[model samples]
Target: MDIVSVALKRYSTKAFDATKKLTAGEAEQLKTLLQYSPSSTNSQPWHFIVASTDEGKARVAKAASGTYVFNERKILDASHVVVFCAKTAMDDAGCSAWWIRKRPMAVSPPRTQKPLTTRVALSLPICTAKS
Candidate 1:
């Protein structure tokens, strides 16, 4: 409904069911949501790594070691774990490349696109599931 309502309903998952798993469709929906999420000035300067399998989750859980160990079980038990990464910097060429990859048919002439590309930054998130 409203922003406040949505925010009020939001919560953090303290525990996850290790016996459960996400369906292919559910996983795809999550990926699509991540792909289209809004960003400041549409400068999507981030990537997402989603892990679903035991092995994949294990690998992802590695990042939660030591001081972050408290999150290891949650990550390993969840149906999916998403790691978000942001690029430190991006240039015009990088932005244009992303545009071409995302919307090949919409690309205009290089000369006409240069100015627009210069003002944009891009980030692509790759999804992987290992079995």
Candidate 2:
């Protein structure tokens, strides 16, 4: 489908059926999708916390209090809640950590090494700059 068509079909789930839950396979698929989602500069600086149990849902719902109270019911009734968190800034240490974690899976031709390093170096300031 084209981007416009997809956008037209997109929607927000205003309500959820509390009784229904995601199957293990469906949940795993969702997690895998999140893991492979693209990121700027290939810096996968994000974390996802999935809450599937009643207690976990309750804990997650707490954040919906006050101004966000309207979302509490949705959060509580959803079969699975995924909290997406991202880093506001990436420091040297954070970069090192990310590199270490991604090193094993990062495979590239020797010819691309210099350009890859340059790209990362250029993007670091943008990622780390405080807004």
Candidate 3:
């Protein structure tokens, strides 16, 4: 399908035709598309977890505020679900730690947004002082 059609048709599909299943190749294609999705400063902070099991999907739905609508029965019947998570806080880089430690959030002036420039600058792979 064209990008526009795909974008328009791609709703938050809670319900799926239970009889359908994605082939290995089709699943790989979906992963490829997901990999190209946008990220801040090329951080690619998102992680994808694919669950095809009804129990696993149910657990995820329960963990995500209980109203996520995984539909255990549909999960058992349909294909797969992808979970995305950000990986920002899990980094140990010196610059990343610097940004986190130096960013005056709660008590600072509103113009502390300069820290965002610092973040984007650090996020770039330019290798300023140390990684």
Highest lDDT against the true fold, candidate: 2
Q: What is the lDDT of residue 12 in candidate 1?
A: 87
Whole-model Cα lDDT of every candidate shown, in order:
0.75, 0.79, 0.61
Per-residue alpha-carbon lDDT of model 2 for 28-129, expressed as tens digits? 999999999998656787899999999999999999989999999999999999999987777656765555565757765387355444435455653442
Candidates sorted on lDDT, descending: 2, 1, 3
Model 1 weakest lDDT span, ten residues long: 122-131
Better of 1 and 2 by TM-score: 2
> In terms of TM-score, which candidate is strongest?
2
Error of 3 at 35 (Å): 2.5
Q: In model 1, which regions exceed 4 Å deviation?
A: 98-131
| Candidate 1 global TM-score | 0.71
Give every collision pair in model 1. none
**Pairs that collide, model 2:** none
lDDT of 3 by residue, 33-103 (tens): 98888755555556788876677667665655457444655555568788787554433364454455545
